[model samples]
Target: MIVPLRKCLVPEFILGDGATNLANRYIKFFNPKKVLVVTDRGLKKTKLVSNVEKQLKADNISYCIYDNISPNPRDYEVMEGADVYRKEDCNVILAIGGGSPTDAAKGIGIVSTNHHHIKSFEGVDKILAPMPPLVCIPTTAGTSADISQFAIILDTELKTKLAIISKTVVPDTSLIDAETTLTMDKELTAATGIDALVHAIEAYVSTASSVITDMNALEAIKLVKQYLPLTIKSPLNLEYRNKMMLASLLAGIAFSNASLGLVHAMAHALGGLKDAPHGMCNAILLDHVIDFNFESATNKYVDIGNAFGINLDSSNPASSKALLIEALQEFKHICGIQPGLKQIGLKKADFRELAQKAYNDSCIVTNPKDAEIADIEKILEYAW
Candidate 1:
């Protein structure tokens, strides 16, 4: 059979200055009876929700707002959201916020429509039923969860995250407006923006990398190199925010197709075990993973440096790898990311056990180079 190098799921992405106002325009497209607005308490308290609510109210859209989502959302929250959606007779799910709330919405949509436990379907393609017409509006510049078919759901009972992969999880519509990200604090904006960079970089060299995914990843990297710092320094600048948002969107698309690697696999393990912030965990592990993968991907490291404006043309492979490591460290420093997992309250004593789980993560299989448990332990030590 003749097939493309990479298979991707497309979403109805609505981008513009005032894309939020176009909700009513596409409402008939989904033919949803009731709308479920999934978000977190912070956003509902902010003007972002007020702005979107105003538009929905103007259109007389019947909606219910569930804003109790947590940072690392637990399994129970998915069931709770499903309850709310069904109780309100919601046929459409509108998710607004960062990865946590958005991912929670996908979980809710699946369980609500499928009439089953979210945990019951944990692996790939376990979602056999179609979800409601879900729409996602990302308020952050990172966590490309907005347009992707993947949702990283946490099983708080087990204290680990699950990558819920299914084509049905891709939103029916995405309302991306850069202006919403302007209010993010400097730290979160930088961290999430860097997270997006990691996504792009990992996808660029993934074993599954295809021509289409490579284009998306490379473009994302170029844009991230140009815009992440600007957004960090000038969060209110519409141009900078717009650029970062676009980069994140591209990164999400790239990784969604090519898939992520050990950086995310290992980071998610750390976050689950220590309850660390997803972005912070990723930031802490970024350099270590890059350094760990350096020997196997010297050419890719050079490309990463070149993408970030490092003059590596005249540099040797070892020098280029070192330069890439230094660049990643510098990127984290500029973003003011935390020093290490130790600083984030991860007990170093737990590293051995955590390393095992991280190594077993499904994301590890598709990394450009596979590492054994010893390698993962060393990476943890480096991140330490």
Candidate 2:
């Protein structure tokens, strides 16, 4: 008997109270004379960036800032960021924000050193050279690009999303400070939290899943189920925020190893096409995709239902799957996630194109059920 080979990759991450305050230590370890700090314009208004800046300044670390990143980061944005990184002669990259800025930072690292357009690196393991030393501080408890081996970049010309997956693109270090998430609005909190849930669910049910990934995915699901609502209601509750952050980190590790499934594949297309929030797109499509995938991976769905605190009987797989979907709907509603793609401005006319893009996404390859173009189209229509 031959045992299948499985490898896991993860970035060095620090998680706990005041983790962001340790930026100076990590930057010092990089031994770079200058750092390129990549983030969005919106983050500059918050103390999250300033807090890290103050720490960097205290340590006498020189840095350059590129804040032109969009909510749905574009191909051009990555190029522009790379230009700044080169012109500033920055040796290290520091990303401080949600998924967009972190992913853009990864793109910048790829293009600045690889001498290729960011789009060229799209798909799994296309990146040849290792990225510049990167330090990430995530202000949101979702996406988990800081630790994951994936970067999502939008192609404005094609109105689609491209995924760049390479272990080399993973950040050298990441700070998980739950305090940073306190600044997010209720909507952002809900969206990002649900995005973490999607990651765990997709990873758990993915055909690539292993025992190691499954453990992390299940724990992440349980943590999100227990803590997401508490964080949403209180907003400043540090305990809940920390749990959500941990869940996000675990989910990141799970998907980074096991890969994602159809929910991410569909959400990536919808988000790239509309320049929409990726997390919210996942939130809208998660239950629908779960229904589509239930028959193929009923045991995983039952496990998910158990994590959600539902008393799902695995013996009755059909009823268990329904319970799982219903629980997800109720959980999403409680977290204030608006239902349906129509609420996010997706039109029926665009479904066909979105389905084609989703079908082409690499994430779909790992889905437990093989999804065809027509099946993807129906899912999009149903989501709409």
Q: Write the per-residue lDDT of candidate 1 for residues 54-168, one digit (tens) a residue.
A: 8778878888899889987888999999999988888988899999999999999899878998987776688989998888889888898889878887878777787777888
Q: Each model's C-alpha lDDT?
A: 0.84, 0.91
What's the number of clashes in each of the models? 0, 0
Query: In model 1, which runs have C-alpha deviations exceeding 4 angstroms?
Result: 1-4, 313-315
User: How good is model 1 by TM-score?
Assistant: 0.96
Candidate 2 C-alpha RMSD relative to the actual structure: 1.4
**Candidate 2: tens digits of C-alpha lDDT, residues 226-279:** 999999999988888889999999999999999999999998899988877888
* Per-candidate TM-score against the hidden true structure: 0.96, 0.97
Query: Which candidate number has the best TM-score?
Result: 2
